[model samples]
Target: MVERRPAGLRHSIKKQMAAVFSLLMMGTILLCWFINNFFLGEYYISKKQNAMFATYQILNMAATNGTLSTDSFDIEFQKNCGKYNINYILLDAESKTLKTSTPDYSTYSQRLLNNLFGENAEHQKLLETGEKYEIQIAEDDRTATEFLEMWGVLDNGNLFLFRSPLESIRESVKLANRFLGEVGIASAIISAVIVYLISRQITKPIEELTGISERMIHLDFDAKYTGKSRTEIAQLGQNINELSYTLEQTISELKSANNELQRDIERKNKIDEMRKEFLANVSHELKTPIALIQGYAEGLKEGISDDEESRNFYCEVIMDEAAKMNNMVKKLMTLNELEFGNEKVEMERFDIVALIRNYLQASELLCRQKEIEVIMEAKKPVYVWADEFMIEEVFGNYFSNALNHIAGKRVIDVKLNRHDNLVRVSVFNTGEQIPEDSLPHIWDKFYKVDKARTRAYGGSGVGLSIVKAVMEALNQKYGAVNYDNGVEFWFELESAGEKVDDEKGMETEESQNG
Candidate 1:
């Protein structure tokens, strides 16, 4: 089977390289476009202004000296301006004449006239008044072709007309674009290679650690991570190595533990199966003997001999043995049902006082036999939500146990009170003190704190276990509270938070139920 790669490692060096390279290319293209369009364009505009100033100075000098039309002056201007890459023009105030160094005059003339002079009367007025002015003029004269037409200006007589060749700037900008493209391409290539190499170096140890992990999956714990890299990767490698060692130890421990758990589960399953089988077996085994003994004892009781005492003794022994066997079978069945998770409880709200009164009535005979008085102090109709039958059984077990264990005057006190959303029912009795060490385990199945005293009173050790199961089934709370005089066994059940108005006859059963 193909193993899965860990999360966060799906992307490789090639993929990362492509992503970085793509972003770098996009950034370079934007920067080059911005410089060519904005910064470099601004530089060209500044150069044009300087050229315009040179033109103005030349004209102003000629105008001062009265040599504005001299051939020598024109030649001197041309010589001084050689290859500055611009057009030269000198116009009278009428704007009817011109001069230049390029032949494509239509586009140049439109731009020149529009920028240097103004429209209609404004151009005329400005020409008459202003000594110098410069403006960008768009042109369609035949002097310039290709590209986005022409860029030039009309000088307002501040200097003899001087124009820079637009072609020179066009060529210079093209060269700038080409130079930037070359530099950017080279930088991107270098960055991609260096970054890819650096990433590979960083990931090398991790890859080795991954291999070690793969080996571990096959129970090959012999391999140790060996690759060394700087801090972070080195730490990662060390962690992987430590994990491998710990995993090996854990696996060894788990092997034995797993075996033990499997055996224990199997043993438990067998015991469960045996428990079911034994219930039937024990019933079959003991029934015949019990019946025979009962028959002999009853036959002897009906004998003509005046031995009433001996007959009564034999009858008591047989009844006692039968009761023990019956109790054992009932407990076995209860435990089985609880373990198999088949206990069903019917839940409803009932008067707590009434339930206790009924239980006390039933257990009064047993309490009297033990010289115990069951004292109940509670509100008349303190209501709680519980399974009535299950709670009754729980109280019966508690009452019987308290009856058997009570010492001296044998007084068992039962109290019912409401606390928040729960109703607490506590049963306290005077008794021999329970051992501190045994309190925690008292809730465990078949756990008896006073084994000798319990057995003397026919305690089966399963009554409390049944009580626990019943409480748990109803999802109620049960616990034991120890005091100096005796132990109080208490439980909490969900209570109905309603108050009855006895004066207005709102205490009707219907209202209380609702």
Candidate 2:
């Protein structure tokens, strides 16, 4: 039974975005409200101070010009005081008003001049100390009025006194509260809309990447990021796309390896069975030779054949069997070397035609003895890449096999045909074709169509196996073809060196016939 995996925690980018943007917007709104509530009172007081300062600056400027008692000074004084909404009094050193902006301060039941600087102990300090300036906020509980008092001594020994009411401030703050409520509502709505749009814009890629991730989790690799922006999110999207490709490739390889692993398991089981059968075949093959050599040796030792000729014949039989065993062992070792890559194939370009011609010349004696007819055709300077010694062995094996198996017309045809980038070298003998069923398996070790005939030739049945292994090690192709009334065993080698041109090939044809 397949076990179920637990689902993991999922984070929603959309909800997180909404929450973050909302909190940010709310935080800004709250900070603005808190500041207005805390500092509005101080802000109003600072404005009154600035107005009073302007009035004082006008008087100081007139005195610096030595024009304090002039009509121009009074004009400048009235203009500055009115502009800053301050009521001013110009007082002489005796503390009596020489000029005043308002003459109706008696309505408050106090002589304004004395009440500001003379009556109040704190206010008296500005009059006594030379160059001393002071500011005071006085609240009138009866009329619910707030006023700022500023007094300073002029450089000309004249006293400058000023007052600015803050009556409008309380009313302005009330109006501000009402206005802020309405504005905040409108701003919140606008901000919410803007924030929502912004959050969507930000989280869109995140959501898409999440979707891609979800699909990737299910092994769907087709979806891809299409964003063209150069943001970090865009880069992340590209990385996710790359991750998808990598995961797809890795999974495919793993699945392929898993299938191969299963096949290897099956093949291992079959190999064990084949090993048992192989041992039986080896035992069978060695048994006959051992029995013959042992019987012949015992016969010689026991004087079963008393004559010298018989003794010599027994020795010959024993030696022949021993020699066959030795040859078989050597062939087995060569095949092992080829199969296991122990045989080093030193590749070199050589004239293949010359190699074949030399091989035929060496076998001339065998051809003559067998009364075999020979046909040879090739192109001159036909170069090929191969291990020369190994190729020579291949040629020898085919030629010897043909010689041993020749029948009927007794003709052996050796031909070299160039096919594209390769040269097919084939040896053909006029004899019975191999059975169709045994064609593919002919290259397997110890496979023979005619067992009796093979035994007669002392064939270990590993020659074609060696041919297959050698060709495979060289990464070349080799096979056999059944022709009419004969069989052809062939192998190919890579064509090397400069190719003979068409014009040169035609001219060399006559010289190539051998």
Best by lDDT: 2
lDDT of 2 by residue, 187-241 (tens): 7777767777787788889878978988897899999999999999999999999
Q: How many Å off is the CA of 230 in candidate 1?
A: 25
lDDT of each: 0.66, 0.76
lDDT for position 101 in model 1: 60
- lDDT string, candidate 1, 203-270, tens digits: 66767777787798887888997765558777877888898899999999999899999999988997
> How many backbone overlaps does candidate 2 show?
0
For model 1, the run of ten residues with the poorest summed lDDT? 505-514
Give stretches of model 1 more than 4 Å off: 1-306, 499-514
Residue 168 Cα positional deviation in candidate 2, in Å, after optimal superposition: 74
Alpha carbon deviation, residue 8, candidate 1 (Å): 21
Give me the overall lDDT of model 1: 0.66
TM-scores for all candidates: the values are 0.43, 0.50
